[model samples]
Target: MSAVTEGRPRSPWAAPPRPAWEGEPSKAGLAGKGLVLGIACLAVLFPLWIVIVTSLSSKKTITEAGGLVLIPKGITFIAYQELLSGGQVTRATIISILVTLVGTLFSMTVSVLCAYGLSRTSSLGHRWFLMTLLATMFFGAGLIPTYLLVQTLGLTDTYLALILPSAVSVFNILVLRGFFMGISPELIDSARIDGAGDWRILWKIVLPLSRAVVAVITLFYAVGYWSAWFNASIYLSDQDMMPLQNVMIQLVQKQEAPMGMGQAIKTGQLSELAVQMAVMVLALLPVAFLSPFVQKHFKKGMLTGAVKG
Candidate 1:
């Protein structure tokens, strides 16, 4: 027996103490875990730091550093100013914001409704619906066929084209459904016994209990919409309708006027590299801001349906 239990008396036939595997972790194990976590943090943060610094650096500072501008003697917001002030990048940023906001809301509403409905085993044809959704998870219509369907639906050259096709992710639906099903059946039955209907029960009881999963899914959908460029490129014929990621690619790859000033790639003042870094920073900022919201919910949500409270 361990020292704490050494002085205590126990029944001769009593079960042995909990196994050593369940004991406190060793110093070496803790140290290894700490090292791995630190490395992971460094991996994510280092590149972001570099991008932010380079974007803030003056042309002269960038030149002195000769590359990514690690150490900055001076800082300037010129790159950000140019990117946000006016022009292609500015328009693209606005479009991306609009799409992300609208798309997340639309996706959440549809996903939540579908998941809630499907989670009810007593719902008419729910099993068939569940099987259909599961089938979608495994098979998708080819890209060309999907494009044709969108075109047929007259969604071409519009923001709806970017949204409706992907508005409901089946995987998200399943996750939410699983969480909803984990709610205490006894509690739900009691609510029903008190004359609470399904909708009321859902709004009053289920949603409140499922906040963590909801928040995590919301973050996931928002990030997807925010960072998406492929749909924008394919659906939006006008360059003006392009999202931030697509326009960022255009500016960086073609070295066009993303820094707001319509100057050519090698304008002696604001270099192409600075403009690229600034664009990246702008693209990354939204997801970074939204990430904290997920942490708050997810830290508690992973076990949302695992055990009854």
Candidate 2:
């Protein structure tokens, strides 16, 4: 029906030559992408750089520099030394470590159990149970009521006060539940055929398979426990039971002098800026050190648990 169909020469403009880079992104486009990534990296790294520099700086230098330092004129480990060797600070640090370790272990155990149970639909009233758990995420008993409950339970002035009340986070439970639901049902059935009980299957098969999510939620619990101060301050009346954060708050805000500082630093008062920065560094070190090891899996773990179900 056409000139080309009749085997005649078509118009020259009918077909255009393919561009050499037609399927490939342009050099400028790649460069723009690289620039954006570089800027984002810089944005994240700059704050870390500042914290490191400030932490390493001498108290005198930090004070002279107006509380922030991008580059230190003189570097010293004196702040860290003071925090580690100083009596009260050292004790508080130890308390914090103990609390975080114990609390996280407890939290992960309870959360994993609850999540696995909720993941299974065979239980009677399972829908109602799940809805009740989900409802806690949106609404909670008021602080006063929680305080009253803790008081009535005689958990005041004790470590259990810190660990038990906040044992199971609804969000963490949901995350783990979604992850459990993502596990192939065939694997569970096979385990069941092998005479594995629910607990045994969870311990051997489910937990090992869900390491990424477990680690992520473990980190979440650890961070929360490490940073917890409000409950400790409220529940523990004894000064000995105070966590590192509460101690740091007392030192920084209340200007409470460390025990041996009177004899060590003739100035009588710790350098507020140095003390604050030192406490921050101490508080941050555990998370900072461990986060990198688990950071790679964090997004995958969270999304797998959150979005899949």
Candidate 3:
């Protein structure tokens, strides 16, 4: 028995030491990771820094300095003052705000209703209707046809040209439909048993629970409407009916004219660059302010709509 015990295999503690390379930290690897991360952060931050500096710089300084500013030496608000003062630009800004607000409300309401209706599996022709809606995303009616249709509807030179034609967005509808589908089936059944009709269920149950998705889609619609100019230029012939973007384009053109056209032209050429920057800043403020408010919900909303289905 003693001989058998001695012949048995020894424990792993009896093994030889491993090579030093096995456990040592790699300085090169750590340095590479740090370098990549630093570069990525700089790439993202540089554009934002430049925009802020340009927006705050004086017109004369910006013109003299061939490149972007790292630090603004002299800050001024003269550009902002010129933009807000009475002109076609101010009128257009008012028009744009109104359109954005009204269009967002209208688009969201219609999208919610359409999406909710289509989300139900038992709804008639649901698949076919959904496919038809999606088809419009890839292929649009030609511009001429769309223009003719608008003309036939007597919507030219009117706000309805902007509001009614774009009342529903196919992409937004799909996002909302996916969100509605993600709601628990059991909750819907319970609502039914409690004598809740479709409208009541949508209002009391669906909408309340869908705040994140609704807010995200509302932001999308608002930004789109605020930035829209092509439709306005095409359908609205009246200068008074122009939106801010169109007016800004006209202002830029005048600024680009030769130096000796007239007194007004000379003044425009002198102030054009500053005025352009100011208009851009004004147009961007609403989006900048509103984005952070909805940004918290944006990722969750997009994921709920996209990956869920």
Of the candidates shown, which would achieve the greatest TM-score relative to the real structure?
1
Q: Would you list the clashing residue pairs of candidate 3?
A: none
Residue runs of model 3 more than 4 Å from their true location after superposition = 1-52, 66-70, 253-270
What's the TM-score of each model vs. the native?
0.89, 0.84, 0.80
Which residues of candidate 1, in runs, are more than 4 Å off? 1-21, 264-266, 303-309
* Per-structure clash totals for the candidates: 0, 0, 0
Assess each prediction's global lDDT (C-alpha) against the native.
0.84, 0.85, 0.81
Return the clash pairs for model 2, or none: none
Sliding window of 10 residues with minimal summed lDDT for model 3: 256-265
Q: Give the better candidate number (1 or 2) by TM-score.
A: 1
Candidate 3 versus the native: TM-score? 0.80
Ranking according to lDDT, highest score first: 2, 1, 3
In candidate 3, residue 148 scores what lDDT?
Answer: 97
